[model samples]
Target chain A: MPMTIDSSEVLKRIEDAPLLSSSASRLLQITADPEHSLGEVADIVKTDAALTARVLRVVNSAAFGLISTISSIDRAISYLGERLVVGIAIDICASQLFDKPLTGYEAQRGDLWRHDLRVAIASREIARLAPQDMAVDLAFTGGILHDIGKSILSEFLTGTAQSVLETIEKGEAQDYLEAERAMLGIDHAMVGYELARKWQLPEPLQQVIRFHHKPSEADEEHRSLVYAVHLGDIIAMMGGGGTGSDTLQYHMDSAYTDYLDISVEQLTMTLLHVEEEFSKMEASLLDGKDGGT
Target chain B: MSNLILGVGDFGASNSPGDIVKTFALGSCVAVILLDPGTRSVGMVHVALPDSSINRDKAKERPGYFADTGIPMLLKQMSSMGCNVRKLTVKLAGGAQIMDPNNTFNIGKRNILAVKKLLWQHGMGPVAEDIGANYSRTVSVSTNTGEVVLSSPGRPPWKI
Candidate 1:
C-alpha cells in the first residue's frame, strides 16, 4: 500500500523548515514593491556582507562579459538589477533545497535549479510582453521559487514515479498534480503555499507558488504575472530543462491568452531568447564554475 | 570509446567507430539520428522548433534549432563525411505532448509533423521512432553500429 500522509504532518514539516535569511526575505519583499528603488535594494544588500560579495561575484561573472569588475554594491545592483541579486541571495540561502537530488522525480542534483533558471528567463521574457503594466522582475523571482515545494514533496514521492505515471496513463488521474493528491493526500503546490505562508513571504509570491499551475485561480491583480510564470514553466520544460519524469506533466492553461497578449510567433521568439539567456545564466549561477574576479 | 553530447539546437557527426552522439531531457524537443552503414558514420540534430521562418537570422546561426534548417544541415554534414543520403538510416525520438492534453502550444506535435514533412521533402523518412507521450526522453546513437537507444526516468533503456 502507498504511504498515506496527514496534512497536519506536512504542516509540521513546513513549520520545521528553515527560514529564509533576513536579507533574502527582505529583498523578496522590497523587489515586489514597484515603487522600490535601486538605492533601497542596495541598502538591503549593504546590510548583509555575504550577500554583497555574492552580488559582486555574480555581476563580475563572465555571464555579463563585463570589460571591468564592478566594485560597488550599488553599481552591481544597478547593473544586474534587484531580481538577479535577490536570486543570488535566495540561491545561496536555499542551495540545499534547490540542489537536493529529487529521487522521487528521478531527477539528478542541480536539475531543479537549472529548470527554475530557465523558467525565470522565460517568465521575465513573457512579462516584458504583457499588455498590462507588469513587474517583469517579480515574474523572474516567482519563476525561480515557483517549484520549491517539489524539493520537499520529492522524498515522499520517491520511487513512485512509475506508479504516478501509470495512474495518469490509466485515467485514474487528470495529471501529475492530481496524481500527487490522489496518492499523497496533498500536492506540492499546497505544501509550497504552506511554506510560503510560514516564511511570511509577500502575498503575491505566495499566490504564484500556489497557483502557478492554475493561473485563473489566482487573485485577479496577480493573474497576469501567474500566467507569465505558467507559460514560462512550460517553455522551460519544452526547451528540455525539466526536473525529472514530471517535466511538462502539468497542464498548459490556455486561459493564459486571456491575461497575456503573446502570439505564437512571439512565443517562438521567446523560446529562442530563453535559450540564449539561459546558457549565460546557468554558467554564471551554477556552482563550481569560475565566475572570474 | 567517445561520447558527443548535444544540447538543444546542437548537431554532431562522427565517422570514427565507437563514438556515440547523445542528447538528454527531451521534453517537447525532437532529435533526428542518421547513420550511414557504408562509412560507419553517424549524425544527430536536436530540433526545438518546426519553422525556420520564425527567425531566419537565428536559423543561419544555429541551423540545428529548427527542423527546416536542422535537417538539411545534418544531411550536409553527413554528405561532407562521404555518407550517401539514400543509403543512410534515420530514426526519430521525442516530440511528446508532455502534459498539454489540449495541445495549446502544440509544439511537440508540430515538431514531429514538421520533421516528417521536411524528411519527406528530402525523399527520406525515419526507419524507427519512439515519439509522443507525457514523459521526457534521453536518446543516444552509436557510431560503431548505428544502434539507437532511448531512456527515460525510472525506465530501462530501450532501442528503437
Candidate 2:
C-alpha cells in the first residue's frame, strides 16, 4: 500500500528514527541558553561514551586537519570551541538520521548531504556578514538542518515526483510549498519543523526550519536569521547542489533582500565564496565518494 | 582520454578522445558544449550568470562565468583546437530555475538567450540541447562519440 505523506506520517518517521542520545540532547538543549558555558556543554557531552567519540572524531578528522590530538571531550570542546562542539554533537545524530537517498525529493545518494552542507556554509557566511543583525552561530545549525523534513517527506513524494513537480511549477499555486500543502496536504518545511521539535532542537532552529522557505512569514525578532537560512537554501539550490525534483518550484521574493539589506550582487558573490568553500570541503570531506546526481 | 572537470567560470577544449569533459550541479547556470566532428575536439564551459556586465572585474577575471563573455571565449578556444569555427556541433544544457527565490530574475533564461545570440553572431547554431527545467542536470560531452548526455535526479538520462 502506498503511504500517505501527511504530517503525521513524517512525524512518525522522526519518532521512529533513532533518538539522539540523552546526553547529546542535553548538550544541545543548553545551546539555546545565551549564558551556556563551554565547560557546561562539555560536561553534558562527556556523559555518553558514544557522544564523546562522535565529537572527538569530527574534531580530529582531516576535515579539520588539527595539529594536536585530543583525548577528552573537555579537551575537544576547548580546542573546537562551544558552538562548533554543539553543532557537531548534534550532527552526530543528524548524520545518522538524515543520511540516505531521499527518493521522493529525487535526491540520489549523497545529494542531500552536499546540499545541506552547502546551505550550512552559505548561511554561516551570511550570518557572519550580518553579525549585528542576527545570531550567526545558530544560523549555521539552522542552515544545515533546514531541510531535515525532506529526509522524511522525500519518502512520500517518490511516486508523485513528476505530477507533484508539474503541479507546483505549472499550476497556479504560487510555489511548491503551496502546491505541497494543496496537494500532498503537507510540505517539507512543516515536516522539518516537527522533526526539529521532536529532536528537542532549539526553538529558534525549529522556527527557521519551519520558515526557511518563507522568511516573510517568520517573526520580526529573528527574521534576519530566517532570511539568512532562506538565502542559504536558495543559494545552495541555485548551484543545483544536491537537488532533486522540485528545483525550480521555489519562487524568489525580492522582499527578502530588502529585509536583510543585501543586494543581489552581494548575494551572488556570497554564493561564489560558498561554492569555493564547498569545493574545498567536498574535496577533503567527500572526495571520490560522489556518484553525481 | 581523461575527463576534465569544467567548474563555473571555467572553459576547456580538448581534442583527445581519451578526454571526456563534464560539469555537475547546474541550477540557474548553463553548460555549453561545442564539438567539432572533423577535428574530434570538444569544448565545455559552465556559465553561472548571463551577462559579463554583472561585474567587470569578474568578467575580466573569469570569462567562463557569464554567457556574453564565456560563450565567445569558448567558441574561440574550440576553433583554435583545429576545428572549423563555423562547422561545430554546438549542444547546450542546464539553465534550470531550481534555486530562484521568485521568478523575478531568470538567469537560466538569460544564459540560453545570450549563448544563442553569440552563436547567431558567429553564424552557427546548436544542433541539440536539453535545456530549461527546475531540476539540476549533470551534462557531459564525449570527444570519443561527439555525444552529449544530460542526467537529472530520478529521471532517465537522455542524449542531447
Which one wins on TM-score?
1
iRMSD (1 decimal) for each model: 2.3, 3.4
Model 1 misplaced regions, further than 4 Å: A287-292, B98-104
Record all residue pairs in model 1 with backbone atoms less than 3 Å apart, i.e. clashing.
none
C-alpha lDDT score of every prediction, in listed order: 0.86, 0.74
Q: What is the interface RMSD of candidate 2, in Å?
A: 3.4
Model-by-model DockQ, in order: 0.65, 0.46
Question: What are the C-alpha RMSDs, in order, of all predicted structures?
Answer: 1.8, 4.6
Error of 2 at A160 (Å): 1.6
Best by DockQ: 1
Any idea how many clashes model 2 has? 8
Off by over 4 Å in 2: A1-7, A35-84, A129-132, A283-293, B1-10, B13-20, B49-81, B98-133, B154-160
- Tens-digit per-residue lDDT, A6-97, candidate 2: 56655677777667667657866776666777778877877766667666765566665668866787787786666556555655666764
